[model samples]
Target chain A: MKPHTLSVLVENRPGVLSRVTGLFSRRGFNIESLAVGTCEEPGMSRITIVVIGDDAKVEQVMTQLHKLIDVIKVSDLSENERVERELALIKVNAEPGTSRAEILQIASIFRALIVDVGSKSVILEVTGDTEKIDALEKLLRQYGVKELVRTGKIGILRGSKSVPGSK
Target chain B: MKPGAKILVESLPREGTEIIFGYPGGVVLPIYDELYDSSLRHILVRHEQAAAHAADGYARASGRVGVCLATSGPGACNLVTGIATAYMDSAPIVAITGQVPTNLLGNDAFQESDITGITMPITKHNYLVKSAADISRVVQEAFYIAGTGRKGPVLIDIPKDVSTGLAEDTPLPEKVTLRGYNPTYKGHKRQIDKAVELIVHAERPLIYAGGGVIASNASAELVSLATLVGIPVTTTLMGIGCIPCDHPLNLGMLGMHGTEYANFAVMESDLLIAIGARFDDRVTGKIDTFAPHAKIVHIDIDPAEIGKNKRIDVPIVGDVKAVLQDMLSGLKKNNAYEPWLKKIKHWKQHHPLRVKDDGRLHPQYIVRALSELVKGEAVIVSEVGQNQMWTAQHFCFHHPRTWITSGGLGTMGYGFPAAMGAHFARPDVPVFDIAGDGSIQMNIQEMSTVAANKIPVKVAILNNMYLGMVRQWQELFFDRRYSFTELPPVDFVKIANAYGIDGMRVDSPDDVVPALKASLDCNGPVVMDFRIEREENVFPMVPAGAAINEMIGGHPRS
Candidate 1:
């Protein structure tokens, strides 16, 4: 499968995610992962979509997105010139208090944020690259992880310049 | 000379286009007016999308740049789907769009939008004409970028003001230079030697060819290489005519709907020489498991495609025809695979394509009859549906560029306009479209274009009264929950008659040949609707989510 990243500029309105994602489902090209948030521009939102397809076909997908009325701009960043990250939260079993200290020590090594605590369970949030997040999640699995949620890949161009030849 | 439209017209010949296909709208009136009585000939199409497909069909049929024009905003947007289709298939087309005046571009004025910016990813290159002086040179560069190595579509957006403006004598650029656009043509000698060495040592070797053969006109080299080494050749859908179907060494098509013998041969082979064919997921069931037994030698013009799917033992990056020539020169002719060929022939004989033995008409039988009736000489255009796969599975195309289908994009409504373009290129030869009813309805507007131009294209719509392919899957996997697959039958004969064309519908098997002949005998365009079996599924199907070779055929049931 081809890996494609789409940087979308939207109007930060309600149901915007559904509109953007609905297009992909309608076209049979599914969104493998998606990230949306407020951008530097107020009232504007940036959505990062990592799709799987051939480079040429991915370009076609981006074109299809730009055709949508809500999309302001779409960019496919070069791998070397882009920075990517994601976040994950996991709730693991603490073995009734015996494994709680061990879990905290391991979480400290990975710099995971402890969000919730109980006598038998603890929730930890980890943020990093896909690989780092996966590693931390695997380590937590040994403590009987109960629930897990992950934010997909989000990317932006590193340099202080927009895509060439576009405003 | 006139200002806006006239300058754009002058830019035409410099870009190496003698003709363009398009339709006019209010926004593009200026360009249409200038087109009249000009050196360039613009063939008016009934729909804007046909203009794009016609241009693409022209480019693929004849190895030159194809051109199409349209007005903003719906006319321009109509070209988007077809443009994306060409972009996916890598066809060389220059699409010129007429936009609203510059003042109204950003204000959401009538018939105004940013078309050039919208088409950025779908084109190899694109430009916005801010001034009339840039028109000629930009057109020159658009042609250069499109027809150059790894051909693709390009866009040129002309605001109404620039198209009608004049500024002194304009000069077309002699050459175009792009900082990061370069394609390699020559193969490294080390990789070539390594490939030859593997071929010499392998016991069961197979050659996988793709559309690159047609792109490079490398059929002769392909035939010679297959014959020289005595190896069987299996082709992808786009690679259909690289070798004669009757050639003893041909294994037919290999893919989702490919023949049983072809898929078996690919999986059972020891050394796989993949030339110009990417290991698409559709072609190779699961990437990690595909050709697991074979040592791969991948030869392609695009370097990025080499190791993207399967691990490569020998990656020879070069044009297919050129690389094959170098390999042929270095290797000695050997007929050592006689035993291997005999084994494969036994497999092919035992497990050939089978339809129901009943008297009902089967889609594959129709394709076989059409293939035989045409004597494998005419260009075959196929609509996107089960009919397309049936044609690929049964039709024995003998030459490259003979079979045209929307392979990459699989766009319905592609056959008629594409056949129109193919006939435009080779008028002396016969051209026919194996159309599906659902697909035909998508772009039936082209009937007028066919009739007006007097293009004799014989269209055979496999009228099952439903989306046959999707219905086939729904029958087998989705518990026959036919949602939107069924269509309220429209009288295609009346539809054709309304367009001033002859038409007929055949319900019995005996009428198939006669109906075909009747359509071909008519002086102009004709449509023959064959009311085929509705429940017939494309057999020898590879069950979805299964390995390529673990088909619903010969293998033990899972």
Candidate 2:
């Protein structure tokens, strides 16, 4: 099985998300990650969903997505080379102790930004692929991370390619 | 020049709406008052559910969007099942419900309910109009959406204030533009060419047609394709009218309770041309084993259905009529699949559908008699369960849209009201609702509406005095634990009389035809209650979730 990212363009209407997610769950397809936001056009929203399935399952999910009336278009981004990102905000306990300077140093190495600083804690915002983010989180856990919030994932076709769905 | 109620009433006729089925209450009284004087005729139903079913019936019979109106709260809730019925069956219907008032909506005032919210999952789309100004535009869009590609029900909930408030007169738009809702109507040529190529090369090709054919009015094209290519055709329950039942190439219906030969043909075919059919579970049985040998070609107007249920080797997303027309256009004549036809005919001959004849009346004989007497001229509606299956089995439908019944939802009590609505749509045609004793009583109150409206639709009750299907299941699978399936006999003739309609009760098999003929000859609404064998079961029963070849009680042939 391979990870398939589906880029779905839908009308930004109430309950459209529920309709899409409902189809996924009904067909017993577990979505690994999902991200939804405003698209280039007003009244249209783009949803990027990650699912682990073979060709047969991925094809079925795509076809079912197209069945939804609110869904304008759907494309499987896995077929094309694409750029993907996930953003995480991690609040780590700097404490007055030995690892505070080391935490900032590790953040510098990963190109992470220090969004907030306090005497006891420093919040670092990291943007990267899932693996990079996971690696940074693993390093920061040694410094006693207080809390973490992450957006699942968002993707786009690289260079001159656009999401082609309902036009 | 008029309030929103008047505008709503007038706009219906402009959209070619001739009749509406509804029940009035406090909030919708003003609209009903406007309806009384306007050219739009309204039939007052005993229940809101019947109103929706009647509208669904009208739509299925006439190929137009049917309209139904109901008041707020429970009235709107009652319409839900019927709305869902139409949605599942892909019938085009528009349901209108009145709310208490704009202010009273959140407060839950008298007779107010969130009908739009309640019906969202069941309908194709829904709206809760907050202003009278939007009524005309909303109604226009509602009709357009309801009747378009992959047609289904749409609901519009209006607050009382909106219906009564004055709005600046706005002309109805001749067109509607929804940013999201566009249906593909023409088949892509490349896919059609691929389909034709597959058909040309296949040794044993079969056509599996479904409700989409009827919705697209593509039956003629289906016939041309099958006749031209010499391919055998089998219809799903929804596709019964796609070809005449007696057409030489037509293999009756396919599924559980379907003809044995049809199921065998589907299993044995090499290339299955699925036109507008969704490949429902009942048709497929066990999904993995269904048509295992066939390379499937699925053509539908809605792209969503292409590979949702079954894998399609060739998927063509477009309107059925358009796609079939292209497939038939340069098709070379061929006389292949002779061996396939021979095998199908052998099965048909050996395992023919029949019931043992005793002194008792069989339900099937009544259906057969009705088919013969009507001579394929009348519109037939059926209640769910054995009566529905029997009608599906025995009725020789020779034309499209002549058979209107609940197929997907299988809602009982749907038949009579639907027949009433069908009669209103085609005033000159005879309409009959074949029902079981249990199913008919669910909405028997609609008989009063029929009598009051002077709709001369006939009701033929195959009175078995049980919820026959449930009892059959209990008998076969549950060790004959009858539970509450049996019902104390009620006199349908008396009920019809109380509603001011003439009726009769026939006991013997010999009297079935004469009774049907008498009901047809009657000048007004009539109910012919024919008492059928109490314990009879529908044959060719494939246990649920079993393969198509699996059968329990059926013809005793391999």
My TM-score estimates for the predictions, one after another, are 0.78, 0.93
The total number of steric clashes, by the backbone 3 Å criterion, in model 1 comes to: 5
Candidate 2 chain B weakest ten by summed lDDT: B549-558
lDDT of 2: 0.89
B234-300 per-residue lDDT for model 2 (tens digits): 9999999889999989998888988888888888899999998998998889899899899999999
Chain B TM-scores across candidates:
0.96, 0.98
Tell me which residue pairs clash in candidate 2.
A73-A166
Chain A vs. true chain A, TM-score per model, equals 0.88, 0.96
TM-score of chain A of 1: 0.88
User: Which residue pairs in candidate 1 collide?
Assistant: B3-B164, B4-B163, B4-B164, B4-B165, B5-B163
Winning candidate number (lDDT): 2
Fnat per candidate, as a fraction, reads: 0.00, 0.40
